[model samples]
Target: MKKLMLALAVASLSSAAIAQETYTVTDVPVKEKSVETNSFWSNWFISAGVNYNAFYSSQEEGISKNPFNDRGKFGFNVAVGKWFTPGLGIRAKFDGVKGVQVNGGVWSPDNIDFDYWNLHSDVLFNLSNMIFGYNENRVWNFIPYLGAGVIRNCSQNNYMMGANVGILNTFRLNKRLSVNFELSALAAPKSFDGIGYKASGNKIWRGADKVFTASVGLTVNLGKTTGFRKAVDVDALMALNASQLDALNSALAAQQNENARLKEELAKKPKEVIKTDYRKEYVGAPRSIFFNIGSSQIASRKEIVNLQVLADAVKADSNIKLKVTGYADSATGSAAFNQKLSEKRANRVADELVKLGVSRDNLVVEGLGGVATLKPNSYNRRVIVDVVK
Candidate 1:
């Protein structure tokens, strides 16, 4: 039935959180996080772009100041930077050529046209990587930066200290190249713009000379790109593997003994009535499909055995409707991330059932976000199927 599905995606081992790591259901262990650091210059990059600049000053308030009327407010920008880590980086950028500015203590219909350059070093923070975990292949990244620098006004032959802030949006075209869009604003001392308190009845304005720019550019990485790689704990994984094998062997033996005991008990009783083919032939099989932490794909071929038996039963009786539920552990990821992970697990199981000859219409697939229903959280990262009615 179609209905709202709540998924409890499960895993004691974390995919994104290292140390709060997660384990898998297969014999071979998988490492889902990275903690290694890269060498210097490994993540360096350079970019170049043209931008339309806008200037504003409190002194120009009385007049309608339009950047379009100021032909000097158009220029080019360039930068070179490096990512020290997935979430942090730094860059030195230059934007300039010519710009319009209001002169100190003077108000003019035609502002000063000044040839200059603004150079600043920014500390970059990749918001996406910081919040969602590092995913190198991620196409888009949102980076905000802050910095301080100096602006040289060539016409006035003077320099002023400046500060800047901005957001940089990057769309990765490949491992080595990215298309970038940037929005930034810079602030300088009012006197640097030839405008001072003396120009306006000696009034000290609250703001300074400001320039805003919007630009699009291309960035090419200077060297090899380094990404985080999973940390391997061989001894721990081997121990885990041994314990998991023991558990599986025990469960299988117990189930076999139960089946045999039931068969003997039935033989000792009176003749039973004939049941339908689906009910009479199929033996009880585990109805849960397990997966690795932070993964939806079935990891082992053995996981499909019981699922195959269930598929046959559905084929024998097409009327049977099975409920397929998926889950992820709450300990590994954020709620929103777990919700999506859970749905993927459920859908993967449903797809497998369909492959096994079960009609899609006869299946109700839902995700239950994150839960800790099982002893070991790794077992919870799975899809569970049962008869709907």
Candidate 2:
């Protein structure tokens, strides 16, 4: 819970600091990050491609196993799909032209191919998007799917049921254009091929038919809602504001306790008795200016009024030497960065002292880097002004 609060506090402070300024990272401008979301009508696409359809059957167990010269023939496919999220989607596809097979379960090169159409609707999963986060501008994406469809041999007027599975690879060319490569397999009853060899040589035909395919095509995204936009949560920001208020109240309480301690220490000190002929020495209690965590600027210029009083005493005594030291919290920033930040803070306070009529040569400005001498991390982010004897 402490870690969460610290993160939220940093975020809240950053939000307030950059409310009017804009910054960039790498090439893209920075924006608040959130989840990807789209409406039902968004992310819809259509595609068309040519494929090589290879028919598989246990009946042709011993047929020549050369792919380019086998019963696999050229065909075409068209599909329509929609992405529901970065990881999931659905697609309906139509594939067919002609499929090839052997007559009498024997290899004779007699060209016994049949005309058919296969329609399948599959639940698609984008592996790239699911594994890595979604990037609409990403060049390539890998997707796989599974579904059931109807297969009809138009030449024989026969219809059968089929199950389908496949992997799709797409390369994005632009906002609306993509090149697609797909590999798929479908399984159906052997009779759906319209090959009436009835007995597969002598015995009765059995088992299912498999069609393996490899296709290449192009896709067109339908509309403008191609990617997700980050959303700003108003409620979380409001909570951060409340947390910031609590932090300020705590700082105020710390300051009050510090004032009471200073008063107690002063009461114990002996009073100085200077004769009328003696020169008065420039004297004052040590003063400190607080800052917000990780910042070098003074949190409040209210401390400047107190410094002005110290400056007047210094102007009266040329022998008075004052040291202005700055520090950062040990909990944040790198050692080198904190050192530099402290130096900057000390100089900032010294400049203010000079503006109030204190001689620059009498003021020694130094930075002690990071320290934890004070309670609460915020108290460590401060600059102290003390008389140097």
| C-alpha lDDT values of all predictions | 0.74, 0.76
Estimate candidate 2's RMSD in Å: 15.4
What's the TM for model 2? 0.51
After superposition, candidate 2 runs with Cα above 4 Å error: 1-34, 104-110, 196-206, 230-389
Write down the lDDT that model 1 would get.
Answer: 0.74
Cα-based lDDT at residue 191, candidate 2: 78
Cα RMSD for candidates in order: 14.4, 15.4
TM-score of every model versus the real structure? 0.51, 0.51
Tell me the tens digit of each residue's lDDT in model 1 across 1-389: 01111000111111112211222434334344444578886889999999988877645555445555553367899999888888889999998987777533234556678788999999999999888877879999999999999899888888889999999999999877899999998888876666653235545443577788889999998864455544556777889878877866775566556555545555565354323333322323237788898898986778777787678867887877788888898767778988999999899888888888889988998998988777567877888887754
Return the number of clashes found in candidate 2.
0
Residue range 117-161, candidate 2, lDDT tens digits? 999899999888778777778899999989998999888899988
Q: Assess the local accuracy of residue 56 in candidate 1 as a C-alpha lDDT between 0 and 100.
A: 74
Best by lDDT: 2
